[model samples]
Target: MVLIIFFTSLAGNALMICLIHWDHRLHMPMYFLLSQLSLLDMLLISTMIPKMAADYLTGKKSTSFIGCGLQIFFFLTLGGGECFLLAAMSYDCYVAVCHPLKYSVLMSWPLCLRMTLGSWLLGAADGLMQAVATLTFPFCGRREIYHFFCEAPTVLHLACDNTSLFEYLMYICCVLMLLFRFALILTSYGLILATVLCMPSTDAHQKAIATCSSHLAVVSLHYGTVIFMYVRPKTYKTTNYDKAVSAFYSILTPHAEHPHLQSEE
Candidate 1:
């Protein structure tokens, strides 16, 4: 099942990227951002699923310390980037739909580039800080992470030192990362809704609704699972349920994102 999802996500996202790249009509800011999203999804799922599948097949659940740290770094980096990228995509959609005449100027190539670069930088910064902080603590006992991947919270569970304060700090970071961007998405869509309603043509309203619905579905799936996983109290015990949620966002969400990317084109 893991291998199947892994291959499907890879193929789907790769295909989205290629289609956007090869199609001249898709050279607009929206598709450019979608292609960047596809690329990020490709990297995001690849960061964890490949190693996970390998472990599942080989019966080797254990990874070296450095390997674990690297996994967390890349996973958080891509995940964080996707969060910001989705917000940027929402704004692109807003500008395109609500201010079509100004889209060319507002969502210009340089601005798009800046947004993409900003997403990556912010994500990298979060990933680096979390990875370093989570791994630095002294871990005792068997040091086995209950979860499938080296997620920051799961890894922090093994720490011998007191981490309550740090866990609260992590929670705050998750809130800022997830909720703040989610608020941006909501604001963009709210404006979109108001604009769509004022349109005289029913056909135009319907089309706008259809497009926005698809984007919102992708956002809900991604954000809902991530917030459920990371935004909770540290006192919460890790369970198979947590693993399932992780799989949803880490594996399934990327696959879900593919259709939305293709639909944009």
Candidate 2:
């Protein structure tokens, strides 16, 4: 099942990336950002899924200390980058819809490039902080992680020394980042809604609403599962259901960016 999910995601995201790269008509800022997202999704899922499939198939669950650290680093960095990118995409949509006249000028190529790069950089910085905190702690005995992936909370639970400070700090950072991004998403959509409502052309209003609806669906899926996985109570029991939820956004959402599908509309 894990293998099935892994390959399916891998193929789907790869196809999206190919489609975006092959089509010159899809070179707009929206599609460009989405292509970056597709690339990230491919990289992010590949980081853990292949190892997981090998482990599951071979019944070998052990990961070296260094391997575990690298997994955590890439997982958190890519995951955080995705969240920031989605928020940026939402802002792009809001600007395009609410202020169509200025959209091109505001979201220029340079600004878009910076925003994309900045998201990754910020995510890497956050991951670095977490990695430092994680590696500094002593691990005396048990190192078995219940989850297939090396998640920070699960790893922290296994530490022999106190991780309360590190965990608390991580929680603070997660909450602040999530809250700020959620607020930005909501504010952008609010302005978009107001603009759509005031627009006299019914057809234009409908088109705007349709675009927003698609974005809202993607946002809900991505943010909802992440919040559920991280914010909920941490337990030792292994659950396939959690993996399924993670797979949804990480694996499925990138396929929506395919140029063929986008062009069909």
Best-fitting candidate, measured by lDDT? 1
C-alpha positional error of residue 208 in candidate 1 after TM-score superposition, expressed in Å: 0.8
lDDT of 2 by residue, 214-257 (tens): 76777777787777766654453346666666667555553444
Cα error, residue 88 of model 1, in Å, equals 0.2
Look at candidate 1 and tell me the lDDT of residue 112.
Answer: 96
After superposition, the stretches of candidate 2 with alpha carbons farther than 4 Å from their true spots are 232-255, 258-265
Could you tell me which 10 consecutive residues in candidate 2 have the lowest summed lDDT?
256-265
Residue-wise C-alpha lDDT for candidate 1, range 100-196, written one tens digit per residue? 7777898899999999999999999999999999988999998898888888888887899999988888889789879999999999999999988
For model 2, the local distance difference test gives: 0.76
TM-score of each: 0.94, 0.88
Q: How does model 2 score by TM-score?
A: 0.88
The lDDT for every candidate, in the order shown, is 0.84, 0.76
- The TM-score that candidate 1 achieves is 0.94
